[model samples]
Target chain A: MSELIRDFARLPQTWFETPIAAIALTLAAYFVGVRLFKLMRHPSWFPPVVIAALLIAAVIALLPIGVEDYNRGAAWLTLLLGPATVALAVPLYQQLPQIRALWRPILMTLPLSATLAACYALLIAWAMGAPPEVLASLAPKSVTSPIALSLTEELGGSTALLMGALMVTGITAIFGVEWLSRWLKIRDPRLIGLALGINGHALGTVRAFEISHQAGAFASLGMSLTGAFTAVVLPVVWHLFV
Target chain B: MSIMRGLLWLLAFLLLGQSMVQLLPIPLPAGVVGMLLLTLWFVRRGKMNADVVAVSHPLIAMLALLIMPGVVEIFFVAGRYADQAGAILTALLVGTLLSVASSLWLMRRYMPPLNETDHE
Candidate 1:
């Protein structure tokens, strides 16, 4: 018993040793989780993000891995966002011909979608008797993270909630776009892009790629438009309500 | 011909965001502000093509998944929101319904049937 105790004591603490290695291991596990999710037919009930979350949770719980250690590695993946978001331009350009033809429809849809998203959140909150701050954060749920967070903070909503809401909104739209598009009979890539981008934020953009190159482009355009319109419109509406 | 020019246009849009983030009031985060600014650019330009359309898709697609890393921090803030989960869940459910319904309405309003477009 004493020997075993001594051997155990020799082991370094979670945060103390090989912090980078721990992060690398966690990220590796995340990659595996993503692959496994794909194998499971990318089941709607257990999405890639949800699966990743569960797998990461089990890892942290079962092992002595600290989050800080894991974050060090995973965060490097996040730095790709700036370039990736910019890269969406390639697909946007590819679909430009189709977009030009449907410019009239595209122009009208952005504001309508943005307005509905904002107003719907507000109306639902009012109906359910939610407080103003909650409504404020909810206001920007349909837009992307940066804008959603900004609006949440500005209206004194919980940034954390806004973040969570952003994730949920994005993920749902990611999965939800196909069904919505089919039901709506939307064939235009620009419209698909706009709807997903506006309504799904970033997540919809992800799903847009699975549909087609054009669909993906429109998703990017829509997302940017949604973010932009919501940023401006939400504030004007917030002032009116507050 | 203009496919390459679209690249320059995208660079301009991205830079416009970076520059304006510093200028915008109301503490709007720059990326979202940039996204908005980009939308205005699209509306103003009002032109599209295959190459032009393909430019931004992948970037946005990958970015959608970028939120995964942030979920780890949720544990830290989870406690503060525990009491309000009901409200949050309600907002999600209600908000989702409204989103789908509104999207459906808009699609019906603007888009003609695909077969009809081909016929025309």
Candidate 2:
């Protein structure tokens, strides 16, 4: 077994050198993760994203290829993040009437929540003695990746660190918010979705959509509005303070 | 063909968004601006076409997979931030929880009571 494993590892990289290999590997891992998730009855402990990322990370770690090479191969898929974000409008469109009715509450809450998210991240990181770059990267942690990466880049922070923090924040909200909502006895899907969106961003929106269409719509709204709010406000505040 | 059209529309919106982000002085992201623009267009039309819906549903469904590459990049740079990894992780956890709790509280406080039809 050891010999086979070593031989497999030593095999020429030619076999997995193409972009298709990277894309195919990602899809394959995601499907396997999905299967594992279902086989385990959708346990939160083994969310597909978590599993797929870890599996791909492990494979990339063991292989001779660098992260940049893998990303270049996978760039085709990542490019879709733009369209995927725009696609969020579909749900938002579906929920337009509801949103119109609740626009007051949404508009009122979005900026406040956005500010709070940034402040909490910055203050907590500062108190923990995190470097300024880390704090800046974290300030936009609740925004989705593309926007968060852009914001972090503009602020001269590490996009890689921000990406990791964004995922952690998202996964934490996904796993914990439902229980917290339940504990608080918050029954409205709108509120629940809003909370998920503001706190979790894209991943949280995915989870919200799983719960119901209404929840998904509100989550989309929350995510977009929060992204816009953070983009406009965080830079101004960061400039003033740090 | 409908999916193709939908893709084209999405691509056009994406292009417009990117251009606007560059041209504008405000700090808005292209994606968010695109979403807002799309939403406004839909609102003006007062309905979503089937083709748009067809394209968007699948795209949105696979969003997590789309973001996996970025997440995977984290593993490569994880060691670089090892000194502050503990602090970063703690801030992420605590800050996320606080954000979630506060947002939920505020939404609950301000959200109006749902009408009977809204429960549907």
Candidate 3:
């Protein structure tokens, strides 16, 4: 058969079309990203997640496989996000001591910080003439990726757009937290880490860990609570008005 | 804690959370609800099960890879974002900075400085 006889470079499209291939490729790319991240000594701006996405993009560009085809395998991974999100309880549990210790500050800071995070993003985007869909995508910008992606889906926002906003938010929060904390003269690692977590989510948590174990603990707490709070409250509030 | 047992526990909780969403009038996603319930479970026990931790560790760690499909959606939807990238970037930058500032201010201004030894 001509198909079996084809040269390596001229392989059939169907050979690249299997779900196993798609999953394998995705895993391989992500593995490559992790290796690269470690090799580079773990730069903040160049996360393995971002790197893997770019690699996947290159593969897509070079091949005839479209998103629909790739997603046949990836859809299972996406579905896994639900349980993965549920698994956020582990970090929250691990931070229980720190959470109990500073319940007051955590509580006082939560409603305002979480509300402002959503409002500022939405309002600013709205003012800048971003359409309603764009606003939806941006509404959960401060949330961690899993929660944000699910919320964006509920609101009919583009998850792709939300991902971009997430990267920007994470990068901005990482850079801005240092300057902001210095200006506020807040020497408390707990508060600084909480601010970082609430605004920046997982990336912020990683950065917080770099600051100190205490900061890292509080950051995980902050990231988890903000995620749950925004996820629960945003949908209710979103439906009420828009 | 074998991985199988750990996953079973996680899935059971996940089921509980999803059921709550369907039974109640909450607009929140099942995953968020599940996360809350599981936290509460951990609180009640005042400690974590090794099994749950075992399963959750990998799931959370692999999260970056899990969400890659969503990010790649940009390849298809770039047309929608082509005109507004600047506004979006500016909004994210300013919004994130202001958020960090306000949260830090609120905590420092309102939260009485508790000595580190107080919690013990």
Question: What DockQ would you assign to candidate 3?
Answer: 0.60
| Real A-B contacts recovered, model 2 | 0.78
Better of 1 and 2 by DockQ: 2
How do these models rank on DockQ, best leading?
Answer: 2, 3, 1
lDDT of 2 by residue, A130-221 (tens): 88888878888999887788889989899888888888988888776887889899888888888888889998999899999999999888
Q: Which stretches of candidate 3 lie over 4 Å from their true place?
A: A1-18, A39-41, A145-156, A178-189, A202-217, A231-242, B111-117
- Sorting all predicted structures by lDDT, with the top scorer first, yields 2, 3, 1
Q: Candidate 2, clashing residue pairs?
A: none
Q: Per-prediction fnat values?
A: 0.32, 0.78, 0.68
What is the Å distance of residue A166 in model 2 from its true position? 0.7
| Separate DockQ for every predicted complex | 0.29, 0.69, 0.60
lDDT of 1 by residue, A1-242 (tens): 99988667655353436546545544565677679888887764355665666566566656665666556656776755554555554556556666666677667766887788667666766787777767776778887776677677778887767877776666666555556667766666656666777788776776777777777777777877777777777777778769
Predicted candidate 1, C-alpha RMSD:
5.3
Distance from true position, residue A52, model 3, in Å? 1.2
- What would the per-residue lDDT of candidate 1 be over residues B3-40, giving only the tens digit for each residue? 46555555665677677767655345545444455555
Question: Which ten residues in a row are the worst by lDDT in model 2 chain A?
Answer: A9-18
